[model samples]
Target: MKAVQYQNFGGPEVLEVVDIPDPKMFADLVLVRIEAAALNPADLAFQSGAADPLVDSLFPVTPGWDLAGVVEQIGVATAGFQPGDEVIGFVRGQAMHYGTYAERISAEPRQLVRKPRNLSWAQAAGLPLAGLTAYQAIVHGLKVTAGDTVLVHGAAGGVGHLAVQIAIAQGARVLGTGSAASQAFIGSLGAIPVRYGDELVDEVLKIAPVGVDAVLDTAGRGSLSTTQALAAVGARVASITRSSTEYEGAIDVYARLDGDDLTRLVELAEEGKLTVHVDSAFPLGQAAEAQRVLAGGHVRGKIVLEIREEV
Candidate 1:
């Protein structure tokens, strides 16, 4: 199988397309012929060796975390999937010891969910990591509810876009922070778009004078503090991007790909309550270029790598 691998970490140049052996299936894992995979900011951090806490523990890595594929073979103990089943999920960050930038990958059964019939491979590929992160931050971590007001930072990016829709689906009045360029796009997701800069707090106040019920920060700036200051007393505030300072009244959330969460996200997508916005697609051999675009930031949505011609 052809795969993207790097023995050393530096910049996007460190990533290279190479022909590698296929993954061997474990008893509880399924061998997937990868159709598509999505790139995340973490992939760039991992590749550049900046996310040392997450990448230092592993080396000679392949960096993709979200994948959509068809089961080429099933493990002996895997019960819910069979050969040819289309599935999407977060691949274990560690096993990508070589990453999802490959033609084939072996993932644990619990990490995957059936791909929604309504979505294309590109859309499905964009869901796992970003969708799970948003779902967990808004639905699980913050416990967003109907009639609540929620604010999402980086609202035009992959995770932020999903968060906006998920919060709206939960019946919350949503607000999202992005640049002027993405304001209209974010508005299409049912969120009141607030430009993310000096006027963030002021703009939010104008929209919800009483303060919002929850705030989800993905920008990793000190926006969490701003949100805390603007939130209603005892309101939920969380950040998927880890915080440097301990927040007194907010939860710092980093999403994990669990069975239950993946299942629920899939259900929401299949039900049309969730949307996966794919910004771009690259062929497997151009994995490095995919990472380059992701690094430039301000991406409208997720960027995916097409691993198979059919996908």
Candidate 2:
């Protein structure tokens, strides 16, 4: 089996593809032949040692969390899935090792969900982490509801774009912030586009004079600083990029792997309510380059590594 691993944390350049033995499977696990693995900012953070103090890492770390693949075999005790099933998962383990940036991975049954039939392998690969982030923040954290005016920061980003669509799906009127160039893309997701920068607050206020009922901050770097002015009194506020402790009245969100939530996202995709836009797809050997592209920022959607030929 070929996998991407890094011996020392530094940059994307440290990643190397090497032939490793197949993962040790157990009765509680499923062996999946990975077809595609999506890249996320956290993949960069962990790889660069930015998350060292908070999360422990084994030296030779395989960095990836989101994957879409076909089941090559299932453990004896595994239920709800079988060999030949197509699945998607956010398979981040307790420690950084044996990630999805490989030809195969061993994931728990609870972390896997049937891939939406409508999405290609690349698109399905991109959904789990970002979709869960937006779903949890909008639905659980902010409690966005119909008729509420919701504001999403970084609306053109990987998580923000999905956050915008998820809010709309929940019946909220959404306003998303992005650069001027992304206005049309933001609008296409059924949200009013507000340009980023100092004018962001005023622009959001212009659309919702009473202030937005909820604010989901997908873009960190002080993006939540405008919460006081942009959100109405007692409005729900959440940030996936920064800690809630850093911002008053803000709930910090960390995406979790839940089969139930992933199932709902699959339903949304099947119903045409949710979609993943693949900004780029790279072969597995180019994991380094894919991470570099994600590090460049301003990516319109998810970037993925095609681990094998799409079935």
Candidate 3:
């Protein structure tokens, strides 16, 4: 089996494709032949040593969380899936190791759900990490409800695009912040586009003078300024990237892997209410380059590593 591994924390240049033995399928875990793996900002941060303090790395590590693949084997106790089933997962364990960027991965059944029938392998691979972030932030963290006006920072990017749809599905009126170029994409998701910049606060204010009922900051760098200004009294404002503890009256959400929670997202996609836009894809061996692209931080949607031929 071939997998992307890094010996020391650094840049994308540190990654290399190496041949390793097939994963030892363990009891209580499902073994899948990798099809597609999606890149996320966290993968870049962890690789660049920024997230090292929070993660305990064992030197050589495969990097990725989002995955869509075909199940080849399952532990004796695994009940929901059989060989040949299609699945998707947020395949993170207790620490950094044995990720989805490889040709195979053994994931805990609790972290996976059946792939949505409507999605291709690339789109399914893009769903777990990014979709879960938006789903949890909007449905749980912010508690957005009908008639509420919601503001999402970086709303045209990976998580934001799905967050807009999740909010709209729940009947909330959404306003998303992005560059002027993303206005049309944001609008297409049924959210009012508010261009982000020095004028961000003013643009949001112009749309909702009374203030927004909820704010989800998918964009991490210094987004608090805009979020705080648009939040109405008692609004639940939260961020996925930064700690809300640093900001007063804000929430911080860490995306968790729950097969059950992901089912709702799958259902939405199958029903045509949710979709993943693949910003770009690189061959499995080009994992290093894919990390570099995502690290640039201006990506429009989920970036993926394609292992199998596109479906």
lDDT of 1 by residue, 3-80 (tens): 888888788898787766788878988888888999988787767767676435356677787889899998788899
lDDT of each: 0.84, 0.90, 0.88
Runs in model 2 lying further than 4 Å from the true structure: 243-246, 309-311
Tell me the TM-score of each prediction against the true structure: 0.94, 0.96, 0.95
Query: Which parts of model 3 have CA positions greater than 4 angstroms off?
Result: 243-246, 309-311
lDDT of 3 by residue, 232-259 (tens): 8888888997757646888888888777
Best by TM-score: 2
lDDT of 2 at 306: 92
Candidate 2 local distance difference test against the native: 0.90
Clashing pairs in 1: 62-98, 62-99, 96-99
The TM-score measured for candidate 2 stands at 0.96
Q: How close is candidate 3 to the true structure, as a TM-score?
A: 0.95
Question: How far out, in Å, is residue 168 in model 2?
Answer: 0.6
Per-candidate clash tally: 3, 0, 0
Which regions of candidate 1 are displaced past 4 Å? Answer: 53-59, 93-96, 244-247, 309-311
By lDDT: ranked, best first = 2, 3, 1
Q: Model 2, 287: alpha-carbon shift in Å? A: 0.9
